[model samples]
Target: MANETMLQAFEWYLPADGHHWRRLQEEIPIFQKLGLTKVWLPPAFKGTGPNDVGYGVYDLFDLGEFDQNGTVLTKYGSKEDYLSLIQSLKEAGIMPLADVVLNHKASGDSKESFSVLRMDPANRQSPLSEPFEIEAWTAFTFPGRRDTYNDFKWHWYHFTGVDYDAKHDESGIYLILGDNKGWADQERIDNENGNFDYLMYDDLDFKHPEVVSHLKDWAKWFLDTSQAAGFRLDAVKHIDSEFMAEFIRYIRSDINPDFYVFGEYWKNDAAMTQDYLEQIDQSFSLVDVVLHMNFYDAGQKGSQFNLSAVLDGSLMQASPDLAVTFVDNHDSQRGQALESTVEEWFKPLAYALILLRQQGLPCIFYGDYYGISGDFAQQDFRELLDKLTFLRQHYVYGEQNDYFDHPNCIAWTCLGNEEHPDGLAVLLSNGDKGWKKINMGTLNQGKVFIDYLGNSTDEVTIGQDGWAEFPVEAGSVSAWVDRDSLVN
Candidate 1:
């Protein structure tokens, strides 16, 4: 029953590391109480250094030291803490899914310092261990050099700051100048040679065979331990497509056959993200730039953050069965970007649409489950999660359904059983305020039940009209219908 709903808690249940073993011990019962079946912890493995975010892999074997200072000071904690957390989660029937970074690793700031040095692609000993001298290589040229993610574009524009020999490809790395002169092209680095090509983070060269092997080995170890359900692959698009495909295949062939793997492809449209999903058991469903822009405009640009008909339909077109849907994620929200932080009252509505919709595995962000930072202004988010999970089990997860959408609104209904005479319906309003009358094609009489904010269940008689009017609160949502109230 717990596995059916499959509630995955993001990050470790307690503060990561061994210090909170007792807290983890307490978490087992609490998670079970909350109907959660999985705990998705950030990479429990060893990180590069204090500043490393676990993705900057230093050693897969170093699980970290768990003293209080570990969580407070360093990104990783002690090995004992990780093992304990895994054990506890497993024993409580909650699977642990760790985030794995296979594409890149931590290296010395300078090309000379990196152990896996040498940019000559032919001379590289191991793709996984080898580092590149990216600082000297040319950075990606945007607009003109766009869409060359899989290939290399040396004509990058870094603001008129201290340029790194742009014309001199002798160093093997180039800079992509940006408006910020000093910070131009810092994120784009060489896959080999560890060139600081890109800004902020280091990018790895996935073309190397050694990098491929490292990813396979990581999958093997996790499956061998029988602790994790699968993995949430990070920065997948940055790596080669072939590498990702083979990695997914190896995990399935060598590890648990049913192991689940999802990638953070990060593109904004379903069309772009679809091919990546073909490589994994499941993936973030949609990644269209246009769709994301709409969300941005609606949510941030003095407009409502409502799902658009065009964007929703386009995403559904990608892969109805395998897409994992979400309202927002870590990268979606940034300074001056659309505020991904959702309104309290509107959360349930957004979730209700995804869970009740016909396509994609609905994924709820952490704050959506539990109100973050004591901003308990309104709504019981945790309780809403309980209801949402219950609905997923009874309706969304596996049921076949139909979708009806519009520019300002979207709604879906899934039939449970032929004899039931009732069904579950989920609806969302992207508009500011209005009452949308939906004619569900009049059917047999039954009470209509709506649980929008879970604040109250408004019941209306079907009558001969065979139609129900859904009142969508401004910037909010509602999920109800006469159909499957029996299950909840």
Candidate 2:
């Protein structure tokens, strides 16, 4: 059966008190209530000291035990907690996708890390330091600081919190100027050569045999023991494209062949995002944001573009199976001054756009579905998620689409195990408040039609154009319109 609406829980927001393991126990209820199909946990391994983001990793192993407070006792959580969480999610029929940070490791501007790596010259050029390498034009520091060639003598790059430096073993300093101190620490690495500059963030030296072995082992444990369904690779652009391809191949072949892998390419342009899709097993589904942006802009500007154009052209341009469609994520908020798609009525519309669309797997954010009032309060968010999960479970799961595009609307005609195509035809207003009449296209006239959320319906009148006019609250979406296909 087509599964229920796919939901992804953002790991960074998962409530944790001290460490990751402790928090995992506390977060089970939250995950269950959120109606998430998948729980995306932060990196479960040990990380550089005092960092909770989990990107600044220290060891691929070291999934530690929980503390007394029921929070993630360690940097994120322990292996036992991961096993428990995965089992819990499975019991609830939700899959677990481990967020893997394979790009780099903890080593930022700090004395302790250099001490850990055990580099020499303590203050100056550590025997392990390598010169930063990049194009001359690309400036390392934003406000035009002196080049490392002149200022320090070493070269490097940083991502999340991990640093990348060539010409050094595991024991070297990684120089990064801009980093979250809470998560990353910096150190000096020689940069007589300028190879690291052109690389995004810090491209880890994947050529090392040890680097390759470590990643393979990591994948083996996650797949063989924990039974993780997929992976969300962090910072793909920061790593060499070939490295990513090889990593994906390792996971797919060695691990479960059915396992899914999506990467964070982070390029805003669809074309740019597409460039990396060919390299990874499954690229991050980014088309929903594009559609959302188009609809949002049309609404705000009162333009002629509508949902149909988005479905027919823009969204299809990218491979749908690969795109991870979402309206708002960790970075984008609804109703923000920059790109506000978060209107009261439009919530369902956006969901429908994803779940009903015949493209990449549909994944919903935690807050958007349940209608969390704010970013805080786990209790409130859980309540909202439970209620909305019904729609996802009942209407979305196991539905196939015969057609998902529309001329003036976004249509996702879904069919369950049954043969007939039956689902929603969505119409969203571009900032207009008045009721707009819309044609049913190939839908039957006078068929019973209802808005799932509002629970209202009107009979289709044929001579008058087999349409109905309903008030469209501005900045919102009429996400679903239920009816059967019309007879030719």
Candidate 3:
């Protein structure tokens, strides 16, 4: 199969207008031509209010079809518009992956009295207060759509914990009192802050059988309703690993055997990410946070960073098949909580490292492609990103040969195969303008090449030994292709 790329279709700062779905419908053809095979659409369900970006999930069943959350339509649009958008993507031969927020639920219907114990904010396992009765916002009765797709009403028993205590008028990690309740199998979770299970806003308890069954049932309804090919799970590290694996199994077994799912196992430690993958038997792909951190650190250090060790401890190195690699996303974009924007100068280099190489499946951020709005408005990298995707579609194939001998310069070539003969040569530098002699294979020994990235002006002919010197501008990346292919 050809290399596939997924584009995150929404940014953090997209306007709260109910026309995002329409906007994407029109833009699908443009990105499709640029080789976008998959799209990660933002959560389509209704949230706290009209402006809620779908992360603060109110009702999974009320997918902008019910008159709730102060508006009938979500930030994206109404249910009809969402269904239309999915159809448009399928018509264009692109797989749509819907974002699923199952870790927590927000904007409950009302507060209900529940027993709880306050745990230390830093250490989730350590109890800070004794068991006491507190009024918590853990009741979720979707009054708008009382018994539409699902009549399931959530109570305090459905969740393992709540953040706000309506009784004490305080906010803390209040572990819900239950027959058998605690952080869901701490060993399978990330061992940060003793236990990093509870994130925020009524953490759902997957151990509860009712909660588990409801979620599984909802998955079926969602897929059947939207016709999405897969899901982009939110906050999987905080959720139970065992349940996650089981949930994925149930989906593939009962729903779609080829249902593709990836999770936001948002950790920069590759080993930890792999361990989580192991607990789930490598069931799905995960965001390559380790690799994204590497890009951020390299951009921060510039020439001081080691270009060769870029993929050292990344999911791309450990498990390329299960790595959904990306440079930045909604949370990582500027002004967000996890903002660690890669420098503009290093953006091209970072993209080349992911998009050109035959490793992990590359994901392009919507912010980078369509320019961010609001307080952090910026220019887009549309032209260059489009070209890189074009290369991946037409020229990037075969075996890649690495030339990571230099500290400030690195280059690699994809020796052409029977299918894609005119392979690609990618060279990048973090410091001064550099040149590296890379062998293009004896098959193209006499072919002349030009820098497809427009970073270098000179053309060079490959020697009889199939070696050609490729030039890259300082602090930039250049992609070289056959001059004949460039013309035709």
Give me the candidate number with maximum lDDT.
3
Cα lDDT of model 1 by residue, 1-488, tens digit: 21232333432222333343345455577566655555556665545455454665544544563222123223544565667777778777777777777654443222211112323333222233243333432232222213322222222221111113323333322222223222112122123333222222344444444445545665666556536776777666555555566677777677767777666655555544554455443533223333334444455433344454434534544565555556544445222133444444445555565555655555655545653343222233677776776666554532444444455566665545543335556656656553555555455345666653453355655556656666555455566655445644
Q: How accurate locally is residue 252 in candidate 1, as Cα lDDT from 0 to 100?
A: 69
- Flag the better candidate by TM-score, 2 or 3: 3
How many Å off is the CA of 357 in candidate 3?
Answer: 0.8
Clash counts for the predictions, in order: 54, 54, 0
Candidate 3 accuracy as TM-score: 0.99
Ranking by TM-score: 3, 1, 2
Per-prediction TM-score to the true structure, in the order listed:
0.67, 0.65, 0.99
Among all windows of 10 consecutive residues in model 2, the one with the lowest summed lDDT is 181-190
Q: For model 3, name the residue pairs that clash.
A: none
Q: Give the TM-score of candidate 1.
A: 0.67
